[model samples]
Target: MKTVLKALVLLVVVVAVLAVLVFTWIGSRGISARDDPSGLETVVARTMRRLAIPRGDRNRQNPVPATEEVLAAGRAHYADHCAACHANDGSGETQIGLGLYPKPPDMRLSATQSLTDGELFYLIENGVRLTGMPGWSTGTPEGEEASWHLVHFIRHLPEITQAELELMQEMNPRPPAEIRQQIEAERFLQGGDPPPSAPHAH
Candidate 1:
């Protein structure tokens, strides 16, 4: 009995000492975890999974096949709301996005472990409760349509080239038909000038 009691006392002392050491280390130095893009991405991605509803068919949906009409609407909405943080090409917000403590997601080329249309809608319209993504929908077509348009734009973003991106931005910046007509005229003129069989620099 005495031996058992001594062993218990020794174990308690060891635990107390270890606890004090941990407390001292934490209180004196503190634990500021990594907050870089990668670190923030990791924490957010994990939290999203824990909180958001899981998609049963994540393997099937690519989230990038969008129609041209939807693409157009999305581009416009993206420019107005999402572009500042997500960037014009989903390349992530260089200036505004960086200001976040858990920085805004790059959503550019980083494959979201697997986010679906519904999950994305929930996050965007309702928000993740605490994450930086804010809900902007007022439950109207103009509002909801604009939000979905941004989603469609994001779905097919990776394949778009830098030049195409510039073109899209240019077209979306102005009233639709006027810019479309001008762009079409330019295309028609360019097509008239047949490509020399070989590449040349101006």
Candidate 2:
């Protein structure tokens, strides 16, 4: 018991020193959204996040059953709220997703897919700190159920259908400029006058 405690304490100290050094290096260089995390950074962050979840929470089973109805609700919810950052297929390919510092993860990959359902649920309910992901839980029963539903949908990301993608594109939020461009394109297709050009900046 004494040796185990000593080893744990030594590990903590070593990790703290390494963390300080890494942060100092980052501070000197300045972090950019375009910069990918170093292998060391990735490993450390992944380890810390896994350790953040309580053992009990990690072991808890998902209450929601996998059903088409549940999956449909999850799909719609993900399209409406998550697609901007995570993308409809969980590929994290959208502009916002790319721009985030750490970038949203590709959920279709084993890195995400391998996580236990409870871990995923915990992450959805209580988001990781220092990342773009925000806790989605509303502390309500419906919110909890929705999160559980999303877990099932995440598992299905690898097999997402083209029809589902098309539906999600319609559901995705559109910037006003993009919407206007679409409107102009539609007008031109209908044989209306070409959209007016913007004045050139001096």
Candidate 3:
């Protein structure tokens, strides 16, 4: 009986070690594949295609067309945080983005076809871990407030012409403050209070 128990314990230990090894290998395998762009793109495409982690969409609708002020704020965030990885024009960057095993999605080309405002909201808010996206805590604790504004900007992105995109970029857009960021807790606190755009004033 003792011999059987010992065998079982040994098997459990081996299985645990193998699990860790597999994840570590996945992490490293991606880095090495960067040398070959095609292979890297293939892998990245596969991973992002994985069912996005389920999250509640903020119902963050685009009520009013983004004003220059609002769009500017979004642009600033994109330039500071996202542009490095996703690129200013939404074409995506080379070394950091393209080099990744799963290449970033082409937001500019596919926004209309591939994603919805709800799916985009959920994905941005929760973010995919171990992936390039870091969930914006704007509406959540520990995230920047301008996250929604960033979302506003993202919604408008598909319509931008190549030249217009540049002009808007150069317009010195504002950045959403770290404090003004709305989170779920605050909304709960307000209870009956209406959201920023109420009754479709547009």
Provide the lowest-lDDT 10-residue window in model 1.
56-65
- In angstroms, give how far residue 142 of model 1 lies from its true place: 3.9
Work out candidate 3's RMSD over C-alphas: 14.3
Tens-digit lDDT track for model 1 on 137-172?
A: 788867666666666677667776777577656543
After superposition, which runs of candidate 2 have C-alpha atoms over 4 Å from their true positions? 1-24, 176-202
Top lDDT model: 2
Model 3, position 86: C-alpha lDDT score: 71
Q: Residue 170's C-alpha lDDT in candidate 2?
A: 88
TM-score: model 3 vs. ground truth: 0.53
| Candidate 3 C-alpha lDDT tens digits along 1-202 | 9999999999999999999999897787655735544667555754564344344453445444568887877777676777656767676664677865445666777642356566665666666665677776556543534665666777766776677667645543345562345443465576645575655222
lDDT of 2 at 169: 84
Total clashes, candidate 2?
Answer: 0
- The sequence of per-residue lDDT tens digits that candidate 2 reaches over residues 51-135 is 9999998987889999989999999999988998998989999889999978898999999988999999999999989999999
Better of 1 and 2 by TM-score: 2
Stronger candidate by TM-score (1 vs 3): 1
